[model samples]
Target: MGSKHVFVVAVIYSLCAVAVASNPCVSTCAGRPTGDYQSRNGCNVYATCVNGYICDNRPCVAGTVWDDTLKRCEMTSTTCPPNPCVTSCNGLVSGDYQSCNGCNVYVTCNAGHLIDNRPCPSTLVWDDSLRACARTSSTCS
Candidate 1:
């Protein structure tokens, strides 16, 4: 019985120590705002600035404009362009934009449309319904 109690106590202590060591920062600390100096509590807690204002060195300041669409802050009197999908129409077929590549811009076929010139077996015909070149009939080849 004594050994069992000692083992249980050791297990509880180990669990508590692991929990404490995993998360060392408190939830009430604030992060420093961009273009502002770092505050003492900036690195401690996870607080943020209120709407229409930004946290500067753990303090809130006015005149900090926020781009609600972008979910980021910007300087005053800054103008952002409209949505890319609306303006550029690149990669848009009918009304949809393609997924982004690493650095190259390209268009993606929307529903019911297929990419042209893909390799297909001579016996099979390109089927837009299947999104791949498939045999028109099983007897084709």
Candidate 2:
């Protein structure tokens, strides 16, 4: 795959922290707080909303910050950058989406972005079409 854009980012703690910050009550993206107005210079590279800040039903992208003055998330660089949406959820690691084998075998993000290569349990594996876990035993009764 070819890379499209490269930009700076201010992570709050990790990807998960950013996800929670996306909530209506969140106050900041990294360290920059959300309010009725924040100058472009005041905004960080990336930020979430606080007090239910909603722009087009979406949060600002990473490598950019929420511009309350402009009423949108704008790029902190030369121009609006690529998708800065980092997936943080349920207090899990930035990329740890679903758990398997009751929390042992699971999927997660590498470096809080890309999907990690960790596999399922030794006796279990993933079935993509089924989108579920299955036993590795070739012969099953």
Candidate 3:
């Protein structure tokens, strides 16, 4: 019975310790609009505090901007990715893209944005029902 009690107490203490130390990030006691300092295990972060302020916001490299998702500088995409613009168009890569609406109507992306936008034929219009180009005078049916 004594040994069992000791084991139970150890397990509870371990659980408490794990819960308290689970979060890796430490924040200033002041909290949100979070202050400029945080520390863990006696090690202070942002050690380059100048005049009580740190240069946390570093400038991005030329032609690149800080990405919220990556938290780093990267070239801006001209078109949206993962589903590229215009269902039929190819995914944007190195700023090149291809997407089509219906059929003849298409959009191209250069640098992750639309460029060289036009219809495949001056007298034709996209027809979703047939999934192909149709004459301007033709009905979708």
Candidate 4:
């Protein structure tokens, strides 16, 4: 291959390496206090960071996924959203809305800002249509 073609291929290869080798905790836990933190890579995975170092990566209990809002593992039978908590409240009217993270959690928004993330009562799930915590029937999945 010509020199120019070689350079372009090398640059593209480097970019691909960077894209595939990212660790979600590297950005999420940096400068944060020592504690368990959720990993954006997967719902069942979490990480423990201590003094800017990822000391451990752990999995949630079977049948559960890490709940970033609640800071704990929560049960879920359905497939998790690909990119949870990526939904923005900006430009949205103030109201209770289903969280992008899990079905059992909801977010409170005010004037286009996210105020809080709250979990539905145990054994219940947030009902987006009703905008309330209701008994989980078939929709929680």
Candidate 5:
């Protein structure tokens, strides 16, 4: 009977692990703003963080996946992978812009608040000199 109980516990743990792996909405919003963020687990899943609390997992439509660079759902690409945005709006004034993670993704500040993670158009990247997306492959520092 004890062996059976142990087996059951192990099975339960394995099942939980599988669930978490397949769900793909794994993010802790402790210090993050209230908004939707692309999940690193999968391309089609996103997480909703509200006031530093996790809200729920949102899935993109059929044939679509969450674009971390654009902070929106777009058609899946051949090289789709989880590229999460790690920018913060803290200490930034309104109209300030910067990119984190990569030059293809960026964030803006609004009245001391953080905005969504925006992405440059395809084949384009963020250019701080022009303060806009431009056609280039240069890495952002």
Candidate 6:
């Protein structure tokens, strides 16, 4: 009976070992399988290869700063502007539309540009003559 118990314990131990070996490491503390470990570059951990980099062993590319805000690699000089305007007009007299507001301003440049609506309405038109937003029909020019 003693020998049988020992045999059973040995069998259980062998099975547990096989199971552990067959399964991938559950935590990073234990060394990973041959090709399963991730690469560490700077403060970033890459799960897989990107661009031309090899799996589990590539360094961070130059000129790229790790962005904690975006949680990825980004160029150091990449400027995030507060408000980007697509269209801007200059040199307005008293009646011209000086600036377009909002995230995107689509405008066709003319003497005093008409934007959004045809012969743009007073509200939307950018009056180049006035140097300030004015009614399209006001006609600073």
- Which stretches of candidate 5 lie above 4 Å from their native place? 1-26, 77-141
Question: What pairs collide in candidate 2?
Answer: 24-52, 26-50, 29-48, 45-64, 62-84, 95-109
Tens digit per residue, CA lDDT, model 5, 1-141: 697666444432332233334332335788877877655334555677887888544877865766555667787532233222225544333443446657776666666577656887878877543446788532243
- Local distance difference test, each candidate: 0.29, 0.36, 0.34, 0.55, 0.53, 0.31
- Give candidate 3 regions above 4 Å deviation: 1-91, 94-100, 123-141
Query: Would you give me the overall lDDT of model 1?
Result: 0.29
Q: Write the per-residue lDDT of candidate 2 for residues 1-141, one digit (tens) a residue.
A: 222211111222333233223332233344435544332222343334464542222434654555444546666322221222323333333333333233224455544454533566677754321223467311111
lDDT per residue, candidate 1, 34-124, as tens digits?
A: 2332121212112244433444334224434323233344443122211111223222233122112211222234343533233355655
- Cα RMSD to native, each candidate? 22.2, 15.4, 22.0, 14.6, 16.7, 27.1
Best first by TM-score, ranked: 5, 4, 2, 3, 1, 6
Q: Arrange candidates by lDDT, highest first: which order?
A: 4, 5, 2, 3, 6, 1
Report the lDDT tens digits of candidate 4 across residue range 5-105. 66444432332222223322323466788887655335566667788788544887866766555667788422333223315565444566567678878
What would the per-residue lDDT of candidate 3 be over residues 19-57, giving only the tens digit for each residue? 223322222242234333222211111112344444443
**Least lDDT summed over 10 consecutive residues: which range in candidate 2?**
3-12
- Backbone clashes in each candidate structure, one number apiece? 2, 6, 8, 0, 2, 9
Lowest-lDDT window of 10 residues in candidate 4?
Answer: 15-24
Candidate 1: regions farther than 4 A off: 1-116, 137-141
Q: After superposition, how far is residue 44 of candidate 3 from its true place, in Å?
A: 58
True-vs-predicted CA distance for residue 125, candidate 1, Å: 0.8
Q: Which has the better lDDT: candidate 2, or candidate 5?
A: 5
TM-score of each: 0.18, 0.21, 0.20, 0.36, 0.37, 0.17
Q: How high is the lDDT of residue 115 in model 3? A: 54
RMSD of 1: 22.2
TM-score for candidate 1, please give it.
0.18
